[model samples]
Target: MYELKTKENDSSVIEFIEAVENPKKREDAYKLLDIFTETSGYPAKMWGPSIIGFGKYHYKYPTGHEGDAPLVGFSPRKAKISLYFATGDTKREELLQNLGKHTSGKACVYINKIADIDVDVVKALITQSIEFLKETYPDQPE
Candidate 1:
């Protein structure tokens, strides 16, 4: 019985963003909050201790691993700001090409600051991620 560490919580998203050590990253976190909120049309919520998330979906894998996760989220870390989006969306890779100076992993996109990436592309990615998640996890709640 493996439990997921990053479950949604009632933590204060503003407190998390305001507590970011770096001033620039803190500022960028606010910008991202606005961008993600407006794009996803959902209010921001704290997914874990640090992640500011919008919207959510429940997913169950073939291996019996199932949990609810944010459709889009981000964290302002010390080294880099990590952006969370739905994996397995082909449009993600296509949009990342124009996302500007950023690096991405299978689940997270790392960016130095909001200015380092194109906000429009971020919005598009958020939109695509929500659409993909809705289509993929249609059985989940709205």
Candidate 2:
């Protein structure tokens, strides 16, 4: 059985944000905390050591691998802030097109700062990701 390293923990999100070395990143982390919480309508929870996640859903693959993951989340890294959204969602790709300055990987969108991208787009992404996850994983906890 494979073990998941990034499971949610009881760590304080505020302490994690305060520990961020960069002042601007720390500030932006607070801003994002507000955005994600308000948009997702779920309180922020610490995922692993760095990720601030919202609601969670349990997922199992065809191969029998399964795990619970946040519906939406973000991390204020040294180089850029990484926004976590559902992968393989075409609607996510469409929203990223209008997200302004940002680079994306399989499931994470990297942005230099909050001001560099449109906040409304980020909100939309959060909403879409949650809706998509709930629809995809109908067994998710309420």
Candidate 3:
């Protein structure tokens, strides 16, 4: 099992957001933090070295690869923001069409700035993603 570090020392989520060299990116990150916290009603925490994770879940594959992961989260990368949605089943593609300007991988949505997207639509996406995860992994992370 991969355990997250204690939220006691070095690089707090606020501090990490503040350290973003780009003022715009820093602001956008904070805005995202607000949206995530408000919509999910889950506290945000720093995961690993850089990801700002929201809620959590544990998954087990048929191959027996099991581990905990965030329900929804994002990392402020150098060039773009990487949003994570563990459940990217068929619905994800439909959501993407209405998400404004952005690209996505299997479970990550990449955006240059939040301004380029509709906050409401993003919120809906997050809401739907969380519901999907909860339904799919009912006995997830404790």
Q: What's the lDDT for candidate 1?
A: 0.91
Ranking by lDDT: 2, 1, 3
Mark the regions of model 1 whose C-alpha exceeds 4 Å error after superposition. none
Best by lDDT: 2
Off by over 4 Å in 2: none
Native-to-model Cα distance after best TM-score fit, residue 128 in candidate 2, in Å:
0.4
Best by TM-score: 2
Ten residues in sequence with the least summed lDDT for candidate 2 = 133-142
2-83: candidate 3 lDDT, tens digit per residue = 5545222345899899888998999999999999999988988887878898888887789887767788888888999999
Model 2 alpha-carbon miss at residue 119, Å: 0.2
> Candidate 2's residue-wise lDDT over 34-95, tens digit each?
99999999999999999999999999999999998889999999999999999878999999
lDDT value for model 3: 0.84
Residue 57's lDDT in candidate 1: 94
For model 2, name the residue pairs that clash.
none
Residue 12 in model 3: shift from native, Å? 1.2
